[model samples]
Target: MQKSILWVFIALLAVSCNQTTKKEGLTTEADKTEKIVTATINELLASPADYQDKEVAISGMVSHVCRHGGQKCFLVAEDGETQIRIVPGGEIDEFKVEMEGSTIAFKGIFRVLNAEQTEEHVEDHESKEHHDVEQSHSTAEKAEYFVEAIEFKDITP
Candidate 1:
């Protein structure tokens, strides 16, 4: 009877340990699946290479939105001078003019145009008649770095 009881106790202990290990494994898997990267606009701009093509979350104040067809928008960093361009993607159709001056949080892929692409973009911008005058966001408008936003939310206070 004593030997039998000892065997039962050992089996129960093994089962409990196995269950704990499984739970821990599940937690680890959950962590791995929830890998959302939230970053500041400045940080993303500082190292565009690090974030290229990667999905990231960033927030900033909307400094400008293209009035032509609302195809694009610019977000100013905390420094107020620095800005980055954001183009709609995913299910988004356009950025409304009302969004300007509102703080918005955006989730998207950080994209960097290659040298050839950048040259083409600059040429295209210069060709536009409306671009003759340099605006505050002119630099960012022609920057190689921009975000292709998939989702965004206004967080203005």
Candidate 2:
């Protein structure tokens, strides 16, 4: 009986060691990947150039997702005023309309638009918005920040 008990203890110890080794391997791989800087919608908007072309992780509530194709979505900060446009990668394919209003954290590269690009984006966006809504948007309002999302998953509880 004592021998059996000793063997069981040894088995448990071996199993624990194996699990720890696996976890350590996963951590190493993750550490090797590029680090994601966390920022809010307001921070990104405050200085779009600072975060532009840099990989980052941002958290915000999904205010709107374009119905035209689901390629675009807008994330609104807690203030409910500031927003950043997100263009999901091919991996994402599309975003569901139901995702609107849900908070999510996503990894992506913040993109900056020059005056020319901004003007084009605004024009495209206006074509999709309601006539009344489009009339209210100023040139400044149309040229907000943008993000190219590589990965996204619901973070809301």
Candidate 3:
């Protein structure tokens, strides 16, 4: 009986020490140590190649907000002509967010989609009505996406 109790305690200790490793998935540590960069949305969109696979610390006005299934909040930040997506998750804060021009600055992993493969250029003015401007949306995109919670940094022009 004494040996069995000792073995159970050893098993518990081993289980506590042996933490699982994730090759690809969401993790608490992943949310903690993400990289951060600071740049305007226009700069990011203008030369999407510059900040690719880099975390961004961005500040802009909140343009739009949409909650899909109440799990995550997706919003858009607009600076003149450029816009960036703001995706926030978890119990962030109990603050009201009025979009359509509210200043905000946040840090997250920034991803710029490939424009050449998915987007097309339009040069004709008349054809502009019927032409579909290219949109930067693609899979395998590494961008300014942050997991877990994000703090409300500050407002900017």
Candidate 4:
């Protein structure tokens, strides 16, 4: 009877240790996948290539949200003049018009268009009748760099 009780205790200890190790492994994996770099809009625009295809966290004041189906939005940098475009991705269907004029923080991947893609984007922008007059965000709207946002939060006060 005594030996049986000792063996049972040993088995329980081993099982508990194994469960703890598994939980630790899961936490480690989550840490690796959640790694993200934070940056400002101006910094991102200045060296877009450095952050290309990398997950980044950025915050800015939402300057505009496309009136057409909210397919896209623009964020003004701390400089107050420079802007960068953000498109929904990773389960996000679209941006909301109410986001305009609010400060928002976004996490996503930075993408840059190739030469041909940039030219096409520019042409498309120029074709828009509403763009007949220049605007502060016009440069960013027609530029090759933009962010594909996976998550966002309104931090406006």
- Backbone clashes, each candidate: 0, 0, 8, 0
How do all models score by TM-score?
0.77, 0.70, 0.44, 0.77
Stretches > 4 Å off in candidate 1: 1-34
lDDT of 4 by residue, 80-140 (tens): 9889999999758999999999999999989999999999988887777645578777788
Candidate lDDT scores, in order, read 0.90, 0.77, 0.49, 0.89
Superior candidate under TM-score, 1 versus 3: 1
Candidate 2 lDDT, tens digit per residue, 42-102? 7887887888888888888887777777877778776866677788873578888988989
* Residue 136, model 3, lDDT: 37
lDDT of model 3, residue 94: 29
Off by over 4 Å in 4: 1-32
For model 1, how does the per-residue alpha-carbon lDDT over 61-140 read when each residue is reduced to its tens digit? Answer: 99999998998999999888999999999768999999999999998889999999999998987887556678899999
Instruction: Report the C-alpha displacement of residue 10, candidate 3, in angstroms.
Output: 23
Error of 2 at 25 (Å): 15
Could you tell which candidate, 2 or 4, scores higher by TM-score? 4
**Tens-digit per-residue lDDT, 56-130, candidate 3:** 766766544432322223334353544555555333542344543567666655554454533432222224452
RMSD of each: 13.9, 10.4, 10.3, 10.6
